[model samples]
Target: MREARMSAIGKGLRRRGRLMAQAVSPPRRNPDADPGSGPAPDPSWTAPIAPRLVPSPVFVLSSVRSGSTLLRVLLNSHSRIRAPHEMHLRTLHVRLSRSFSADAMRELDLDRAELEHLLWDRVLHLELTRSGKDVIVDKTPPNTLIWPRLHRCWPDARFVLLLRHPGAVVASLTERRQDPNPAAVRAEVLDYAERLDEARTHLNPHVITYEDLTADPEGVTRGLCDRLGVDWEPAMLDYGAQDHGTFRPQLGDWSETIRSGRVRPARTATPGVELPPRLRELAKAWGYPEEDTPTP
Candidate 1:
């Protein structure tokens, strides 16, 4: 018994000594090891905790000039939904003032990305609270470019993929720019299209077309309301009757058509305007006719 007792005490002493050594000199990470070689951390890691203030918020993923502003106003007109002006949550960031700050945040199970997500959630929550709405929809077209980050932020978030004819989108953007370079304009639209395509491929989002939306606002909004688990209200069609913030730059389309307080017919693609090969292909994929030959 004495021998067993002595062995136990020695074992305990050795264990305590090892723990103290580890406490003094923690294990060093391999400096030369590839950080990305390991399996990526799950984007929904925080979902179990229900960390988001406004869970399952909606995002409209689209290229610029794709009628997202019109969609925003229609949804905002709903009693339960608040589709505000462009929040540009992507531009809002969390900066670590000191090197130790990141480490401190990590100790509390938050990295820089998570911190930004928290900030975004708080902003959405604040907006929703002020509007007294149960649902918040952010229709920032650029949000499609950073969808992976958004997925990490709010795993339960819903996406509304709004599509427009590539030709129409290119034309709209070209018209907006003061000194538009044709090549640059097409390239810019292509960039947005590619990101939007990537999002569509990965997410099972509700897809709507600008053409269809304008052609039948009631049918489109009813479908959206069904998806959002809300009753279809005719008030959604008369979006102008409700105050949907403002019609200004960086917010959304402030065009005369939007300000007209009614859904206008979507403009058709310009005649004989040949789309680039890539743009043509995307346009065809989106169910737009391969009407014009590829621009050389």
Candidate 2:
């Protein structure tokens, strides 16, 4: 099987790496016991010992609490789409690109961009194997903050921008009582919008509003399917009907709703938070009702 071959190849490479490390350096001692001594140096292990291949088919971009979880469940329900739980891949991007000087990049035999693509392939291949799906849709909202990096790594990657009223998104965050302050959330939304604009100039990202998704589930989802180039199955209609079983761990506040396997309308208010003027501006720009403007 392909999986077995990959597993065997990985183990063989690791074994060879250990042998090479032994050749270059003395046998390793436990770092804890040798506190005065430094750790063993395995410099050759820095670069990948195998050929690189990776693909990025889809990316779901959004602000926090922008109904991304619901959209993910809807898309993941489709026969061909596999929108997995949030991986916060922006962190992965950060780590892989964190220490790249031109010299270091050359030593690693991959520039930061190539490393990012290879990592996407590495992670997605494992994820696809587990989910038994053909396509990958990275659903982490923070990834929107790194749109340019994503574009550099996977220029052909399609985007789905999940838009929600800034008020509603802030309300949800406030309700959850997460560590992020309301001001911080607003600023993050503003930056996400800025990056969204930049991304639009390059890639045609499909925009899906949270209110519309809640108001007309089927119509919104069907349109989304058309944009994504996948046929809409009626089973995608009943979000709760499918049993995803006890696999695919959902992270963050999303875990609760996604675990329920259902779609619910957003509630209007949350405790101890009011709509700020900046968010109101954002809402207006996104064509949502401003604080003073009543719904038509």
Number of the top candidate by lDDT? Answer: 1
lDDT of 1 at 56: 97
Model-by-model lDDT, in order?
Answer: 0.86, 0.69
How well is each residue in 153-203 modelled by candidate 1, as lDDT tens digits?
788999999999888888888889999999988888999998888888899
The best candidate by TM-score is 1
Ten-residue segment with the worst summed lDDT in candidate 2? 94-103
TM-score of every prediction relative to native = 0.82, 0.69
Provide the lDDT at 242 for model 2.
67
Question: What C-alpha lDDT does candidate 1 achieve relative to the native structure?
Answer: 0.86
Q: Give stretches of model 1 more than 4 Å off.
A: 1-50, 292-295
